[model samples]
Target: MNATDRTPADLLRSALAADPARPLVTFYDDATGERVELSVATFANWVAKTANLLQGELSAEPGDRLALLLPAHWQTAVWLLACSSVGVTAEIGGDPAGADLVVAGPDRLDEGLACSGERIALSLAPLGRRFPAAPAGYADYAVEVPSQGDRFAPFVPVDPDSRALVVDGVELTEAQLVERARADAEALGLGPGARLLSGRPYDSWEGVSAGLYAPLAAGGSVVLCRNLDLLDADGLAKRVESERVTRTAE
Candidate 1:
């Protein structure tokens, strides 16, 4: 694949072509060992749909700062990629206080609701209808909102040199960094169907840019696990072995 032609979205494209029927995402939810598998195309479509929903429903313009606050491994990846591909600016934060949208984790639901002062926070669950929940001051992040459609309108055109990420008031363009990382990843021969299980703190732009999107830019999957300590060693081992995770970078 030509490096210049690739964007973060192409990761899903390549994976769908090479391993469409293969399990692209296998998430182990609990110690009970219940697992869920979502194919590459299916996941890609969901992301596209989600991106479109954010744009149409929430009026999320390009470079709009969105706070992604989910703990589920697969859910996080999908949100991040959707934002990247859709050209929406994102910041990962536990507290949804200043964010435009908060994708709260199941465990953080109550705490997030309680502390969300003048912030639109919500719980994301796959179990029920996405009825709007007026939890005092925040809006509900109903699962149905992300399920309304399956088509992304189109990626908003942003200058490659446009400031896409901000950290501690330090800003950088997405095209500048991602292009560089994409070059390095290609030089290293990391490509489609490769499972990259990563253990890195994503609160920083480097982790998100290099540790996450760079791998995807190379047509490889980057699975993020913020806290592996909670999972028993054996359970983690089983996941690693079965996933055939081929790489890791700090």
Candidate 2:
């Protein structure tokens, strides 16, 4: 399915139908520092609950802004899908002055919280690593999402030519970006159960639209390398081989 035609729910449903037993994400736990695996069905439910949070509980709207300063990890997957299901514009440090929501980028957040103040409304900082909890005042991403559960209001049909993601004032229609990504995956010969790795942060919608969503939309698997520094050349080579990754989108 095309980007405008596709939803995060669409991808999850497709993945499950294709092979419910297949491993959708084989994540390396940065917290406990262990390797873990999740099936397509499991991830589908996780994504749905996330969507429920942002849309049902948070009251996020289309064109509303959400910032992600999160490290690349499994929860990153949940948030990206959450944004899509709600039609909220997810950004990564594009315009601190105009942002309605903020997360992760602590310094930018501090400045934004003061600058935007009332304009800067909700903040989603999921806890991990040195961060123990939701940083006190900031709303908890984990608590917000899963608490919302799986049921949600019906999704709005996204405009094919509409801009779905933003970064530094650049606005590319969801169709344009997803089409480009789909073409690349086809040319690279990605297929069912194929694994894709990206050496970049998964917080941005790019990683979802162009990476995970594209592949699973085409019945392929998406794996993320959250820590690049942790994966040097040798480490990367071993990871791909071990994970059976067919290609990478950097």
Candidate 3:
């Protein structure tokens, strides 16, 4: 881990600086037969745009709580980093009623509506498509995110020591998150160039660590699989070989 990396966003920046073209996130949805790969640069770009949307359009300030009701998809990863970039406290599967903002998938719109603050809904469709009919009282993420600036510059500096995430009622500051990610990386035997395939969901700290932070802190990459149980043993093995995965967490 780089000494300069204090937050997850910093880790992503370091990864982008080291190798813009290197694959950082490879996502698979076995239920949909969808595969999407994002290089460090590409992932950073998405984070930047989403960060801009959060900070500019949504007027999100540091310490603001954002209830994130999304699944373990690439876009969910993007939102996590975006929240880190702007110092928003992301709450995975958190109650929307108490949040400053709510970001949800189409299936979670009803739950998200409990938040009187800003609300954004994602289609979670292949290619990030827009909903045929936009959900009422919530902005369409796929429609709005594309128009956001490619570069994000926070009006207020993010504090590395500020709360950054809450998973399963456990709160972690940005610095703590980085430290834990590094520790998890070491425990998982992840090193440089290590590729970990994770079939875990995003509701728990372990799942978040395996799917995003651990490999990131290790200067490696992750193959995030959704609905992985549906894949046969042969198919899973073939995928491991094809993706060059060195480790797995399920």
Top of the candidates by TM-score:
3
lDDT of each: 0.58, 0.59, 0.95
| TM-score versus the correct structure, for each prediction | 0.72, 0.76, 0.99
lDDT by residue (50-168, candidate 3, tens digit) is: 99999999999999999999999999999999999999999999999999999999889998999999999999988888999789989999899999998888888889999999999
Which ten contiguous residues of candidate 3 have the minimum total lDDT? 1-10
| Model 2 Cα lDDT, one tens digit per residue, 227-249 | 55665688678888988988887
Candidate order by lDDT, decreasing, is: 3, 2, 1
Model 1 bad stretches (over 4 Å): 10-19, 29-34, 94-102, 106-134, 166-172, 180-189, 205-211
Residues 146-237 of candidate 1: C-alpha lDDT, one tens digit per residue? 55577665546644554455443445565655675576566545676567665555566555644456566666665555555567779667
Residue-level error in angstroms, candidate 1, position 209: 5.4
Report how far residue 43 has shifted in candidate 2, in Å. 2.2
* Candidate 3: Cα lDDT at 171: 92
Global CA lDDT computed for model 3 = 0.95
- Considering every candidate listed, which one attains the maximal lDDT? 3
Better of 1 and 2 by lDDT: 2
RMSD of each: 4.3, 4.2, 0.7
